[model samples]
Target: MKKRFVVLVIAAFMLFVFGSMAEATVANKQIQVNYNNVKIVTNGKAVTLTADQEPFLLNGVTFVPLRAAGQALNSTVNWEASTKTVVITGNSNNNASNTDLLVQIAQKNQEIVALKAQVAALQAKLDDEDTDEDYDLDKIEDKLLDQYGELEDVKIDEIALKGDDDFVKVDVEVDLDDYKKEWKDLTEREIKNWVEDLVEEIQAKLNSNTVVDGMIYSTDDEDLVEFYKRGKNRLDVYIINNYKGVNASKVIDSLEGDRYSVEGIRFSIGELDYEEDKELVNVNFEAEAADVAERWDELNRIEISDAVDKIGKAIAGEFENEDVPVEAVRLYFYDEDNERLGSYRYNNN
Candidate 1:
């Protein structure tokens, strides 16, 4: 335990017990004190007051600086703001060890600050790299423009990115002008090969979770003849019907409205004919149920025949109000191996 009472008494005595001798020493705009008068000496030398430190004399008594005296006696003096007290403690024999500990703590604090700075810099660099790899949409557009812009058969018309590059929408035009090979000329094998090439090239440069929304083209003479899509592991090639003065968009729309040419069940345009004597047009198509695995072998022949007959009449009805020359439709239900599952013909005359 600290000798609190003794320390207080010594501090009080040093601050106040000079008996008016301090005032006697001050006169003529200067104060002088010698060894005979009240003075504190450390190591055989008297302590001199600086401009900020002075003795207080009042009513025949004197006050001195206790902090100076306390330090000279090998003590550590501090003010405790929380307790409102002046604490004076004697120096320990291990004072040098305490000073070394304080220095080490300061050095460790500097090292920690430096390490935090390095970590922050590294995290910022990582965030920038991630933005480039996962969020930048412009890079994908530039790549498509460079590769598909100058192809002979097709050209990239538009590129759009959505949802942090999670989806890539590419619109392309298949050139069929100058009486070139129309989309109807492309066989199933050709369609599959083209779609495979496109998907393979794009996915090779993208992450697995990304989806590509490629719209081949629309009707009304947009300089495109085909749009390809997939249905439950089935590759689809849609051939646009663009006979002169014949609007086929309405017909396909009608087919989709009746659940005939969408998703699992789809239809493709086949051979077409126009009967000049009868003023009637004949449309041909290959209707397929893509979801049926091993198609022809797995499906029932009776059901297939009935389905094709209904589909043909439904197609003919779609052209009833059109300005086309005639209203007629022919449907061919076929698979790769079977070659012909069923067929139907209709004429609304």
Candidate 2:
């Protein structure tokens, strides 16, 4: 009983001394003096605190580095040297392990920057490829000149390429005077065959040209081919074999015009007569003008003439004359009654 009472008195005396020391430190300079009995533990494991950050006891008061203490307690630690302050934070409860996590974050940012640079470089390469694919007449013209440089019978005056990713249109002008000298009396059919052969050669060379992505251009693509004379020269170097991809059936489908009679007369084109020998296309159609049969001559001369001209222009895009002049658009007109009216011809001669 005496021993227990003595032990309680020693414990009360120690508590009172420690409390007074804490109050003094808070009120005074808060400086700590060295005491060799400090220890640190983290997550149930003993941690060896750094020498500079070792805890100490000053006049019976304990002191520790804010960083070391925060880490030991699993709390984030930040020191403000300017204000001489320490801040600690955590998710669920303030926590921290070591400086390794900060290093990881920095490395991740660098990787992201590198990836962005790689993507930008790939995009630049693709843009360059597209530019090469776009048509450039200078390159094509150079190729043509190189191929025909030694030929005395051919002179390429101009070359042009146009169109988009869907297709490419090429136009080449050649001086055929030398060609004519060789075949002065050649039939039109023979001349047309010769021109086609020339086109094939040019098309093949263009497909294999090195200026762009080779093998991307083709002449077999429908509606992607055309031939035209050079500007202002008008000496008909080449011809569009299938202009606008229009034909006799397409022209017949495109005819539409009113005769302006009492019954609102309309014109309808029928069978197309191709006079290859004379270079003419005879358009035969019946005009529904039953209300004004007596005025057939006047109507045939004026109304029919104007109608034929308009119709010819509309269907002219379908012709494949290949530099051969179309002498005229011969209109063989008949009334709804099947009576043959006088024919009227139209031409841009």
Candidate 3:
């Protein structure tokens, strides 16, 4: 116990000596510090010193406790040892260089944040515009029909009536089977007369004029006609100068075709019609490759192969099948000068 007490007393003496030495050094040495428009004080007294008056250094570093300097300048100083930086904060009482740097950083950050928000807003607006640009009316119409129900014979497919005008465009799909039973054994002349009589009856009901266009001649040389005959006998009747507000499909249903009407007719038709020019309605039939690449100056090797396969299938009359796959089909629309105006692609798988 005595030995332990001696050791403790010796340790205390060594600590006291070191503390005194530190205090002596602080009191003897003087430091000359220059601060921009800043004054230092200690214990409510102003501190003025020059670099030549007193120079104090500790462990290769100049040590100045900020509390003393800040009190003199009427400001506050904070030291962050982790980041090895000093923060000289200013208020109504004091102004400092460090305060200016912090202010500038905050303003720059705010600007950056605002710019980021603007970019995000612009991107969202562009997305909405792209969606609007891609809107397709044909697909919408198909979707609407699918949602409601499959259009049936004698049912009104669409009705567009102009309140101030006397003209309307009506689209109709007729069920040939309903009239085929009665005319199946009839001669071509009888069949023609029967069709004419039916059109007259429809015109009288609608209180409108009628004009019968030339009949479509079926060619035995075409394979499509043979394939069509293998399935069922069908006919398309294009009625012009009909009732202005009448539903074409409903009118067709009223007219007797086959002995009985079917549920709904399934067929594909091109979206083409006659346009009035001079004294007559010019009806021209034209078809071209669909989705032809603009860069194709002439048919490349790959494109030639594709064209051969497409033309071959078209000749075989299998191009109309929805399940028949084709690589590409481009349809081009041209004027009388043969200058291309627009193009479209059919990608049915």
Candidate 4:
């Protein structure tokens, strides 16, 4: 039979064998019982029974020992005289003594509950991301063409809008045909004014239906200039926009006398190394370490990555104000032992 061994734990039983074992034997006559060549087979396995406990027939009625049968089925047999009952039970241990399987079942149930909770959480996140907001790219691009098609030297090449909610992706490609100065000859003021105007027009004409985070003014797909919504005035600069390199020494002189501190790390600028070809600069600090830092002891025990980040902000900030030709700057830091702690590069600064 298909079965799971379940134990009721408490038990009672009555058997024919117990009657013959009474202390005060009764005066009685017994007839011979038949063996009948009986065999005990349980779930395809043979069970050996003692001769005295074997199957027998009394007055043509068949009987078997309860204890032997229960043992063959991996169970417990109990006899209760007061209740005149026989109880059979099966569980983790043969006699229902071990509860290890019950404990394991409870643990597995808890894990299943935890796993189901995780799945529910992930599903909630997906539903939140599946927003209904939509922007028609074709309609927006066509409207832009209608607004800027009349400028002889200006060409509107491509425009695309994507994503949902307040944050969205908007990229524009514009090409200048001819009758224009090289991009480098155009000053930062000139470049910033042109792009900002276009951005304002796009926002007004579309009734602010789209948000532009960046725009590229190119020639035959060659990126001549790109405007990003970051920097000193937030949207006031471009990458490699102004070509003439600034005097590196002058930029350093402006920041050398200044001292800045963040998270107990006092920092000062020493020298500025400018690479004209790469349009990059390495702004170095004066000393290997700083003094008069009250919390330096606390900072020395931890990582110095974010602790010393703002040290070079004054230098990069000054370079941006002067419309410096450099595209990026690298900042180097040292620990108390003169060992390099970390190096960081600020792009489009």
Best by TM-score: 1
lDDT of 3 by residue, 251-285 (tens): 22222221210011111212222111111111111
**What lDDT is reached at residue 147 by model 1?**
65
Ranking by TM-score: 1, 4, 2, 3
Q: Backbone clashes in each candidate structure, one number apiece? A: 1, 7, 16, 7
Clashing pairs in 1: 20-60
Best by lDDT: 4
**Ten-residue stretch with the least lDDT total in model 3:** 222-231
Worst 10 residues of 4 by lDDT: 2-11
What is candidate 4's lDDT per residue for 229-264, written digit by digit as tens? 421233423443334544443454466546555464
> What C-alpha lDDT, on a 0 to 100 scale, does residue 24 get in candidate 4?
42
Reference-based lDDT, residue 109, model 1:
100
TM-score of 2: 0.24
TM-score of each: 0.32, 0.24, 0.19, 0.29
Error of 1 at 119 (Å): 22
lDDT of 3 at 12: 35
